[model samples]
Target: MIPGIIWRVLLIAIALVFAGVQLDREAGKTYPLAASVPEQFRSASQFPMAAMALDSDNPDYTLAEAERLIRRRPLPAEHLRILAQAQFAAGATDESALTIQYAAQRGWREPLAQETMARLAIDAGDMPEAARRYAALFLRRDTQDALLEELGPMVLSEPGGAGRQTLIEIVGGGDRWHNQFLRRGARVMPADAFVEIVSATVANGSRYDCDLLNQLERGLTTRDEAAGEGLKTVIADQCPS
Candidate 1:
């Protein structure tokens, strides 16, 4: 009753006819005798570093190289994205999904990896997962927080969409870290659009603590300082007294 892992190892050994590779237990790695290894796999031996030099954008070549690379050795987790993207390019849906799952379990969340997973999820018609992955990639503290000011106008359009709702919640929250950017957003975004978001958030029953409300009141004042007459009217009507 050999375990599945042992069976896989045995199968791999059999595939290569038990070629002149030995596990150097002291060093904890398998060392292959080059002469006994098949010619096809000889180049794969260089892949620990060579794989990084490979052109990842060429679908045909990348798919083939990545496929062969994974078959011969366990790659570094950061490099697994090349394999995942290649698998998707080759239309190996199930294999790509499994590879992506494996990469996640190993804690690989590089930008390219996130993009690969998102693409695969979209290709598989898993919109929720795709959207979730895409959102996760951008919503991190380092990524989104760095550009919180820039995010305001980007999410201000589409009058009643989820993006607007999210902006509303963010603006009304106690996190002052982005409050200045929120104020900047209100000033830079169109007066009408900014007013609409504020009014709707208040209308929609988004409760803000007194401190945040005070901040918002001060924020809107500056936002109106240079606003046009119409924008000033809208702000005065909706902003706190």
Candidate 2:
């Protein structure tokens, strides 16, 4: 019912609005998601670790907003994690995994991504994948040690007993992580895993197996020895040479 001139004017106005939106969207397709985040997150000094928490009652909505803004501009590693986590909480786990994979493919070197992948694998009931991902993270030079502790619960998902399976996986790396596992991880492990490690180490004939018992003599003499006693007798009696 409008006049032709008015109709033309309205169409032009709508076209201009659409063009503006397109421009905004193109601008946002890399860090500094200024459109979606507050000033603090945009700041170089406060972003990443110090940015605002994305915790929300409607995590799914939050994820959509993040994805929209990220399409306009890529957010930092921390922000990407928030996005992926929201996807996970919203039960969009497959999407969350792909989001993390995209970040990794984009060369994100943060351990948080790796840890998140492992957790996601756990949620999906993929325990061996979880273990493998955790192991990869552990071997990283700057890997967060807390990730190993976090592995405790996920390890419970492993078959052949969580403790034993985790220890087997850890020790399987031989020279690369064997001693590291013994010194940094073995003692505090679940009692069953410790027992399994000790048992395997004493029975090893390689004399250089990944198991910590291969070097039992040194262990028993340490002033700050591990708390487990089962390996003490095995080392003294079996590998006395």
Candidate 3:
């Protein structure tokens, strides 16, 4: 004879599982409505639509979706970041700033939030803040080359020699990005800036790699003869026989 309590528990579990499946089906049907339907008509299942909303060009749709997701799970840093970006794009500057503050507090290591704050810092002429953010981004393999393309010159031109000094510290410490930075710089950076960074790295007590210097010299020479001559002199000065 089956006990009543055991049968009740078994039935409840099966019911809950079926309910979850039903909810998922309903959410799937609602997902396509995210693009065309007004916010009020959207499904209660907001999570399914989050990705589509975030990718949309309309900030209003993104803002609504982010707000809904945040209400459901208030601590997700990604949701907060999307909310912050939507607010910023929608011209709600103060709201955006406050939301990013929350996002940062929740997930300081979140890359999207970091990039948002970094761009805001750049817009505000806060070079040191921008440099700090960019230095963090430089450590990310996927972002390094793109960042160098966009912000390398700005960092190279940082006033009072602080920027160059920062470069020296990174390369001098033999950070893995050191060689990649130099190799990529040979293509993206002004030849003068590239030469100065390499020269400073060697002068700062890091052992010079003659082969790397030779490669850099050849690359710069291919781009600009005068710059190549300049790097040749630096190579002679920094890498002795």
* Top candidate when judged by TM-score against the true structure: 3
Give the least accurate 10-residue stretch of model 2, judged by summed lDDT.
Answer: 43-52
RMSD of each: 10.8, 10.4, 5.7
Tens-place lDDT per residue, model 3, 40-159, is 444445555765676789988888777887786677776788788778877899999989867855775667766766677667777666656665566566664665567766756653
Candidate 2, 1-241: lDDT as tens digits: 5699899999998997666555444434423443443332333322321223355577656666666446535766655665677678778888887888666545335567867767776778776666666666756667755667667556643336643465465565365565665565543344444445555654653133334564543554452344246556555565566
Clash pairs, model 2 backbone:
28-72, 28-73, 29-72, 29-73, 30-73, 30-74
* Candidate 3 positional error at 155, Å: 3.0
Per-candidate total of colliding backbone pairs: 0, 6, 0
Candidate 1 whole-model C-alpha lDDT, 0 to 1: 0.52
Compute the lDDT for candidate 3.
0.69
- Ten consecutive residues with minimal summed lDDT in candidate 1? 21-30
RMSD of 3: 5.7
Candidate 3: minimum summed lDDT over ten consecutive residues — where? 34-43
**Per-residue C-alpha lDDT of model 1 across residues 40-92, encoded as one tens digit per residue:** 54443434322533445666776766766666565565556667767787778
TM-score of 1: 0.36
